[model samples]
Target: MTATIDTMISRLAAWLSRHSIDVLRVSLGLVFVAFGTLKFFPGVSPAEALSVATLEKLSLGLLSGYAAQAVIAAMEVFIGLTLVTGKLLKTGLVVMTGALAGFFAPYALFFTDLFPGAPTLEAQYIFKDIVLAAAAMVIAARALGARLVPVREPLERVHELRERAAA
Candidate 1:
């Protein structure tokens, strides 16, 4: 029974990796869509005020207010659609990564506000993007079949040279 259960668990893991990855992708896309849609109307998203403030501060006043917020919302919606539809998933990952970089700034820029006592709701919310970013990385890796290797790993060229020398 134990052996049978172990086999089933292994199969389930494989099934999730092979057939259910898209589920994760779509769910993340839905999250982006919901957040972006919320931004379309004022005071709908809890993160709106913080987002606007962060954007203004990051852009040094060049971008702010409803206009800047609208632009961000549109971007999130576009990326979300791309992921949801599985069209240009790679490009969507790139865009998502870039957007998350901006999003992550608040964790540092507003550290005091975010962590005055405990992390405020806004801070906690913004911080969740890190996990989302990590999820995106995994999705992108699976989508691309990326293999992670150490930086000091020997290059293919070196291996080829060694083979030639042996010959």
Candidate 2:
């Protein structure tokens, strides 16, 4: 059992490294974009979701509520853009690490009381940020730069290649 677990872990790690930064970029970018959009829902502003008042009470008043909300929004948009363009990807991942950590900190530390009724919404709103934060950390460690190689290929070429190979 132990040997099998080790082998599985090794294989997973190898696969993770082989696929590289685009995986991390796409995952983190989509998550931030989705969460950021959700923040605009009724009573669900970034400041509210982040428990900004709690942070202020904790003497993290240096992060102004409005500024914090703006930063969160900006980070989400910026990370999404970077991932799409494959530009300055490493720095974007590093910034994403900070943004995701900020998104998760409130639930992880202060708001255990607020999590029972809507399990899936709660999980996505809270735990997903934590998981994505870890992913950002992993992506940061990989240190992906502005990707020079084109990431996506048009679908037409794939079909053409298959036809030629079959012939």
Candidate 3:
């Protein structure tokens, strides 16, 4: 029974190892697209006010209000399309890095607003970006040719299995 369970677990892990990164990339892309689309409409995205404020501050008063929101929305949508389509992914990841930095800028720019004795709703929202950043890192690594090798088996054994499966 133990051997059977281990075999099943290994197979499951192998399947996940094969498909998880692509799933993550697509899911992240969808999230970006959804949020970006929301920003296209004024007063629709919950992050709109804070996002505008952050951009205005970061751009040293050069960007603000609906214009700022539109810029961010366009950037996010572009990143989403590249990630989803796997075309110009390196360019998308580059833009995503900048956007992620902007996303986290509020912690420094509006420390008090985001955290006035216990975390506010905006703080909670920004905190979730850490996960998105990490997911993006994984996708970027994969784009750079990294693979998720299962750990239960030896590297050689895993390669052998993959080779046999390919045959």
Candidate 4:
């Protein structure tokens, strides 16, 4: 079972390297752009978001809330553009990972009350972000030139192919 799992992992890693980076860039860019735009929308007030009162309860000032939220929105927009243009992908992915960590830290460790009645929703949302963060991290690591394990082929078949090509 362990061997089979290792083989599968190796194959998956090879597959990721073979695929084009543009696909990942587009998917991540669209997500960040939409989310950031929503933050700027009139009805999407941070003070009224599900986590707002909890933030105040923790004694965070109004200005702090506004500033932090605004910074997050702006970063998202900037990262989205970076990803879509395939420029500075490593930096964008690193920023996205850091952003995810920053978001999860407070909510996961200190603000249980903010989600007192919506455990399922809270868990689902956090989990989704975790997945996104992992994806970004993976791409960042790969783009940094980490080598994937080679795929295996039958040895006899390899020799046969070489003989045919030599003819």
Best by TM-score: 3
- The candidate with the higher lDDT, 3 or 4, is 3
**Tens digit of per-residue lDDT, candidate 2, span 31-75:** 667766554444666445454544454445776575555555676
lDDT string, candidate 4, 3-50, tens digits: 566567667767765764557767888888877766665458432253
TM-score of 2: 0.53
Instruction: Rank the candidate models, highest TM-score first.
Output: 3, 1, 4, 2
Give per-residue lDDT, candidate 4, residue 64.
Answer: 44
Candidate 2 vs candidate 3, lDDT winner: 3
Q: What's the residue-level lDDT of 68 in candidate 2? A: 53
The RMSD of every model to the true structure, in order and in angstroms, is: 9.8, 12.1, 6.5, 8.3
Candidate 2 regions off by >4 Å?
A: 1-24, 37-47, 54-59, 111-124, 144-167
> Model 4, which residues run further than 4 Å from truth?
1-16, 45-66, 114-120, 147-167
Clash list (residue pairs), candidate 1: none
Per lDDT, what order, best first?
3, 1, 4, 2
